[model samples]
Target: MDLRRLAVAAKPMHRTLHALPRPNCQDHAFLQMRRLATTDFSFLLPRRHAGLRSFSSTQSVPLSEVMPRDGSRADLKILPTDPDYLRLSVESMANMSRSEVSQFVFMMNSYGAVILSSSNRKEDRLAPYTMLDRLFGTPVPHDSMNEYGIVEINPANPTSINTANPIKEHLPHTDDAYTENPSMFCTLQCIQNAPSGGGETVLISGAELVAALSNKELKSLMTPGMVSLGRRPASDGSWLKVSSIPMFWVDKDSGWLQVRWRCNDGCVQSIDSAARPAYEQMDAVARHAIHQLVIPLVSGEVLIIDNRAIAHGRRSYEKGEPRIMWRKNYVGDGEIASELRNGLCPSYSSMFEGMWSMFEPKLVAV
Candidate 1:
């Protein structure tokens, strides 16, 4: 075989290889061949290149269609009256059969949340964590706050602006939006219901919100670094951390829609001027009465929400009300966790690995 002729003839094959969608392990041999072919043909190239090009195997992957495989269509707007809401008795969690577990996982993926209630009126602080461990392995630690990872949501400091510490209504928001990767799931177990019949938990579907936005609005929101999330200054005038991030985006790999939102003034530090209109529009839709599911969690009930695809908050209660709850955030593990990992979306951490080093310092100063 004439080696030079073979190399020239393989030029067409190189274009075809580049056109292939993200390659699997089986395609590695072809990728290596392409690499070698490029090396062999380098002498034919001009000494002065017009622009630099990378031959690395890790070029950016094309954005996939943003449709979830778990039947959670972007257009399906969940309502308070939606019969498909996943609700199960606490007993089911304790003794879930394999098929039952599968159903539970399926519902969780489709609905972005699951509600578990017990008939007995008892206060078990450990029940929520216990059930979580049984179903999803282990809970994620709250490294900034405590060693035990469980956070007690109550009227601890009435004057504090932190939503979890005060009795005021928490507008719909994702927890830890400032961090590179917020928890994938979070659980809120009601130990004591609000006596004044307030404090219902509100959940808004991210998929539905995406479906409602106009193409222009969605594009603006999805632009990189269009929104910033961070903690406000402490009483002593010191900043914690800040992140310049996208408010909405689809993962290039899984094609799942991801959202990072903080409606609270304390966390939502800034929005780019161009994205402000779209951000405002999304906020309006998220807060609209029709788009929210108001779940009044009774005592002995635990609600698990997929933080990647749902935003959660609470209605206000009267000051000094004896309402208490246990909240735990989870990164996910085990079989159900595996399902979540492979599902349409994933935690934001994967998408912004170096975000803290790149943006945190500058944003904190601003």
Candidate 2:
């Protein structure tokens, strides 16, 4: 049976016994981050993957210490190169029950993308899905955060789909649904066919995007609601940029990371809020962030991402031949990890520290 089916079949729980190790400010004292000037033109893009849903399903499962069973860290560079920054782990993530895969996916989800080459082998994929079910829960929610678990078919009229603003209404988001965990990964396999812009997938990095912008623009872009002239998710009519979280946030416990800002021009939310003044403070940074990288996806392979750790979008295709890519997703534990650690550790935090003291308090012991 498919992992998704299995994860849902055996309703699992988030057992707290398997939590990730805590970071010591002394051992890994953060370095005040600053990007090189060249970082402006080519921003980082999201890795690509699925997401989790409702927190109720979490197993109280303790997040396990992140282990590198897949040795890609040294070899893998999060940037494009001649061989392509992509690597296929000799391991296949199929056939394992949802419980088994969750540990690995959870680890990878925290960092960025975990490439499963043999995932399609039918042996590796199932286990991970079940792991997700056992550790996080099942019936992963589909939202902008959890998108890609169910591939979104970009309309021929990119402008139209962009205009449709399907994400605003908060209806049936492409990837995540039911829960609000945001996506964890995207499992796609090429079916067949290639006619002009047929099945080329694209991706961008959230961390790299902000690094490209200036302090002024960065501050302004974080304005709330993501004002936009785009259509609301699943609804009609146009509104300005409207997003749930700021484009950027530096969780002291976890680290630095950018939320999903699938935003565009002429749309800016966050008109009235404490975050407003900060938004107005950044104009150039906002523009630089809006334009960033292209984590392109080719045929015969798939990419995964931690939606909370990153953001994702697709490329436009022509009509006639239908586009197809297999997709599935699951949720994670919760923000408790942030409370436990102070903040999440996305790639960006390594560069700069923000005024995140505002989020201080306590959770699982700082």
Clash counts for all predictions: 1, 116
- Residue 337 error for model 1, in Å? 2.2
Task: Encode model 2's per-residue lDDT on 82-101: one tens digit a residue.
Answer: 11334344344434444334
Task: Please give the range of 10 consecutive residues that has the lowest summed lDDT in model 2.
Answer: 29-38
Q: For each candidate, give its TM-score against the true structure.
A: 0.66, 0.48
What value does the lDDT take at residue 228 in candidate 2?
A: 25
lDDT of 1 by residue, 134-223 (tens): 666666765433455766666653212554443567778887687776777878888888889998888887755655554345545655
lDDT of 1: 0.58
Q: lDDT of each model, Cα atoms only?
A: 0.58, 0.35
Badly placed stretches (over 4 Å) of model 2 are 1-84, 96-111, 119-139, 143-193, 215-244, 251-258, 265-300, 334-350, 353-366
